[model samples]
Each structure stands twice: as C-alpha cells, then as structure tokens.
Target: MSAAPSLPVRALAALGRPVIAAARATLELWGVLIGTLAGIIRSYGKGGRRPRGAVVAQMYAIGNRSLVFVAVTLGFIGMVMMYQACLQFSRAIGDLSQVGLQFLRLVVSDFGPTLTAMMLATRVGAGIAAEIGSMKVTEQLDALRMSGVLPIDYLLVPRFLASIVMTVALTILGAAIMYGAGGLTAWLSFGVNPRTFFDPAMVQPRHLALGLVKAVTYGAAIPIVSGFCGLRARGSSEGVGWATTAAVVGSSFAVIALDFALSVGALWLFGGDL
Candidate 1:
C-alpha cells in the first residue's frame, strides 16, 4: 500500500470536503428551482391537470392559519420599536415629527415583508418539509414516480402558487398591524398626535413596489427550499427531523439573502429617491 498522507494533506482534504458539499448543494438547489418552474409551466399546458382546490387549501394552511401569530408578533414589535424611537427622540432631537414618517417608510419597504417572511420560514417551512420528508421516507414519492407523476408538480407546485399569494397578503396585513400598533404606542407613550403618527406621505410608490417584490420572492423561495430538503431526506423518522430543521434554517437564510440582494438592487435602481 502507498504511504499515508501527511497532516497538511489530510487537513486540506477535510477543508475541501465542505467546499465541495456546499457547491453540490447549491447546484442541487438550482436544479430544484428549475424543475419547480418547469412543473408550473407544464401545469398550464395541454393535458396537464392539477388537484382540485389544492392551491386554495394550501392558502388556508399557509395564510389564514398564520394570521393571529403574525399579527400579534408584529403588533408587539411595532409597539416596542415606536417606544424606543420616541425615547431616543425625546432624549436627543426633542422632535418626533419625522419618526413615524421614517418608520412607515422603513416598514413598507423592508421590515414588514422581511419579518413576516422570517416568521413563515419557521412555521411554514418546517411543515412543508415534515410532510414531504415523511412521504419520501415512506416511499410514497417513489410510488408517485412509478405512477408517471412528477413529484415537483404534485407536491410543490400548489405550494408555490399559494405561497406567493399568501405571502403578499400576510405582508400587507402585518404591515398594517405594525403601523397601527406603532401609532397607538406613539400616541399613548409620547403624546404624539395620531394624525402625525399615522402619516403615509413619505412612502413612495417605489417603496410599495419593492416590498411587493420582496414578498413574492420570499414566498417562492421558502417552498422550493423546504421541498428540496424534504426530497433529500434519507433513513427514517430521524431523516425527516433533520430535513425539518434544515428547511427552517435554509428558508430563513434564503429570505435574508434575497432581502439583501433585492434591497441593494432597489437602492441602485431608484438612487436618491429610495
């Protein structure tokens, strides 16, 4: 046999493994995304049939079920943020006139969609992964494959469609609650007038567009990432558990990454106006 490798060689090999694994995972994710897109296109083609009421069911599962959790979380966050801003203004600037204006602009353009997506990444992502991963581990996915069905079409497409709609709706609801709660806190805690605290004059059309775009992008990402993790599950129940955890982490990371990229692009496109 050949001599064993040196310590440096072993260390280099270990370092290279993770790099290669990351590259492979990235390519696999892109493949899943492409396959999902293809499945969507195919669904619109001749002889393509989607399950009845599937999209609506998913919408209820993803959106309606999440309403109270999202609303309460955002409401409390808004109150705390407004209180902090008022306190800082009282101590330093002594003028709180622009606080609500700036806060509303930030919420519409960033916080509302980003925070809402983060919450969904944990709840929705885990659910998708758990369900699909269980199916995978039980060989149900293989059965579907044998039946001439594309797994992405049957499994992920409805979710993709529903997520896009629900994410946008939730973002809108969350933003409204956040703003309303913040205004209430500002009035009660700082004696600011509701008329001044509820102003939306500073939010431009571009802000609305950016937020919508981000919400849609995040919605698309979560299902794709979660499904990919699910399909990759191995072994038994433990594999499903691992996939669930990975789905949550991956979905959350995708939201943050997409948020950063979209924000930068928006800033570049709109320049000083943004």
Candidate 2:
C-alpha cells in the first residue's frame, strides 16, 4: 500500500470532493430538466397518452392540498410586514401613504411567487422525493423500465404540468391574501385608509409578467429537482430520507437562485422602470 496522504493533501482532497460532487449534481439536474421537457413534448405528440387523470390528481395533491397552508402563512406574513412598514414609516418619513403601493409592487414582482414557491418546496418537494425514492429503493423504477416505460414520462410529466398550473394559481391566491391582510393590518393598526392601503396603481404590467414567469419557472423546477433526487436514491429507507432532505434544500435553493437571476435579468431589461 502507498503511504497515507499528508494533512494538506487530505484537506485538498476533501475540498475537491464536494466541488466535484456539486458539478456532477448540476449536470445531472440539467439532464433531468431536459428529459422532463422532452417528456412533455412527447406526451403532446401524435398517438401519445399521459396516465389517465394523472395531471388532475397531481394538481389536487399539489394545489388543493396546499391552499389553506399557503393562505394562513401568507396572511400572517403580510400582516407582520405591513405592521413593520407602517412602524418604520411612522418613525422615519411620517408618511404611510406610499407604503401599500410599494408593498404591492414588491409582492407582485417578488415576494408573492417566491414565498409561495419556498413553502411548496418544503411540502411538495419532500413528498415527491420520498414517494419516488421509496419506489427507487424497491426497484419499482427498474420494473417500469423493464416494462418499456420511460419513468420521466410516466412519473415526472404529470407533476411537471400540474405544478406549473398550480404554482401560478397559488401564487395569485397567496399574493391576494398577502396584500389583503396587509391592508387590513394597516387600517386596523395604523389608522391608514383602506383605499390608500389597497392601492394597485403602482403595480405595472411588467411586474405581473415577472411574477408569472417566476411562478412558472419555480413550478417547473421543484418537481424536476425532487424527481432527480428521488431517482438517485439508494440503500433503503435511509436513502429515501436523504433524498427528501436533499429535495427540500435543493428545490429551495433553486427557487432563490432562479429568483435572483430572473430579477437581475428583469432589472436589466426594464432598467429603472422595474
């Protein structure tokens, strides 16, 4: 056997391991995304049929199940946010007038979709990973492959389609709840007029477009990342647990990174108008 490596060499190896792993994971994620897109395209092609009612089932699982959770969370967040904004304005500018307008714009362009996606990343991502990971460890995925089925097409495509639709719908619902709750808090706590606190004048069409784009992108990302993690699961239950944790972390990170990149691109494209 060769001599053991030195401390410096060992440290370098340790550092390089994670870097290599990260690069590999990134490439794998891109593959999963591309495969998912191809699956979607193929499903819509001639003589192609998706699993019966699969998309709707997934929609109910991803969207309907998440409604109350999203609403309550966003409502309280909005209330707290508005209270803080009013307090700051009272202390600094002594003007609560523009707070709602600015808050609405921010929510529409960023907070609404981003926050909703973050919440779903935890709930939906873990579920997807755990389910698929369980199947993976049981060799169910292998069984599917043996049966002449593409796992990405049968498993991921429905979730992908459902997530996109539900994410957008939930984002709209969450944004509305957030804004409405914020306005209520401002009125009750700060004596601000409801009319002034609920103004939508400052929210532009670009803000709407940006929020829609972000919602759709986030929706697409969560399922693909989670499914990829699931497909890679090994061992037994422990592997499923690991995949679940990774899916949550990875999906959340994707949302944040995508948010940053999209926001920067929007800012660049729209300039000061954004």
Candidate 3:
C-alpha cells in the first residue's frame, strides 16, 4: 500500500514538472512570435534594411547541414518499410499489385512524411535551440541587438524557411526510396514486376499536397518553439541543455498534434475525392 502511494506521488511530481514546463514554453513561444512580428512591422514601417545576407546564410545552414543525416535516416526507413510491408503483404495477399497499393497508401498518406518531420525536429530542432541558448547565455544576442541587428529576422526567419524546404525535400526523397525498396523486395519475394512499383497514378496528388501543408506547418512551428526555448533559458549551461530538450519535446508534440489536425482537415476537404 505504501509502495503504491509512493509510486503515484513520484509519477505526479514527474508529470507536474512537464506541465509547468509546457506552460512556460507556451508563454515563451507566444512572446517570440509577437516580438518577431512586431520587429517585422517595425522594419517595414521604418524602411529598415532587411537582413538578406543573414537570412541566406541561415537558410543554407539549416537546410544544407541537415541533408546528409536526413538522407541516411530516410534510407534506413525505406529499407525497413520495405521488409516489414513485404512480410505483412505476404500473409494476406498473393498479388504484388495489392502490396504496391498498400505501400503507396501508407507512405503517401502519413507514415513517410510524418515520421520524417519528427526525425528532423528531433535532430535539427534541438541543435538550433542549444545554439541559440548558448548564444543568449554568452550575451551574443544582446550584443547583436546593441549593434542594431534584428536577431529574429537574421536568425529565426531563415531557420523558419529552411525547415519547410528541408521537410518537403526530405519527405519526398524518403518516400521515393521507400517505394523503390519495397518494390525491390516485392519483386524478389512475390515476383512482382519492379516497374509496377512507381506507377504515376499511384502517386496521389492529394497526398503530396497534404505533405506540403504539413512540412510548412512543421517548419513554422519548429523555429518558434526552438527560438522561444532558447530565449527562455536562464543564462547557464544547464539552462541551455534544458531549453534544448524542451524545444525538441515541445516541437515534437506540436508536429504530431498538427499532423492529426491537418489529417482531419484534409479529409474533410478531400475525403470525397479519395
């Protein structure tokens, strides 16, 4: 009886921390969004020089540096998706066409793009938070502000744009690879023609549109979460680490929740067509 009570207490304490942390994170994210928007308006009102160079640099950093990791991760995802899908298809159906359709539905509709975004959020989003948090701790951001540089436009906007580009590109690439791998596996196991794998008709335009919407949504959400978490850091190394973790976790939850919402919205909009 005592053990049970103690376990509940500990669990509640653990749960409470995340709840408070989430609330704080939410406040910080709103602050960053408001501040960034205000800064944008101010820049436009005063005809302030846009930080075009910095934006370009940030785009390159976020999009380019992330490519190798995204490719490798996607490759493995493709391989595994092929193997598992083949096993499942083998159990129920003897037709390779059926397997191909199943693969298309799974990859195009949800798994490929959603999983890719989650992985990117975990990998690059955390890094962005830590980097910003470290810079804040060192007063580098303050120094930039003192020098008349708007950090949001210079740093955050580029990341925001880059995330969308990266998410879309990576997901498409992953889906292609997964389809190819699954096709190959199906050919070997069930003697399906490999060419039957990537029928243009199977490439649903609606799924692609859904993926684009999701990528852009995630792109916007990640930078906001990361930038906010960094801004809220308590100016210490430990704080930086904590902020990084918060950014990843918060952004991940945001991605998943948004995916579900988008799925529902997409269905409502296009379910009749499908």
User: Which candidate has the top score in TM-score?
Assistant: 1
* Worst ten in a row by lDDT for model 3: 36-45
TM-score of 1: 0.97
lDDT of each: 0.94, 0.95, 0.76
Task: Give the per-residue lDDT digits (tens) of candidate 1, residues 20-93.
Answer: 99999999999999998899889877887865488899999999999998999999999999999999998998
Candidate 3, 186-238: lDDT as tens digits: 67766777667656566578877787788778777888888888777785999
- Alpha-carbon deviation at 263 in model 2, angstroms: 0.8
Clashes of each: 0, 0, 0
Residue ranges of candidate 1 with Cα displaced over 4 Å: none
- Tens-place lDDT per residue, model 2, 9-108, is 9999999999999999889989999998899888887788865599999999999999999999999999999999999999999999999999999999
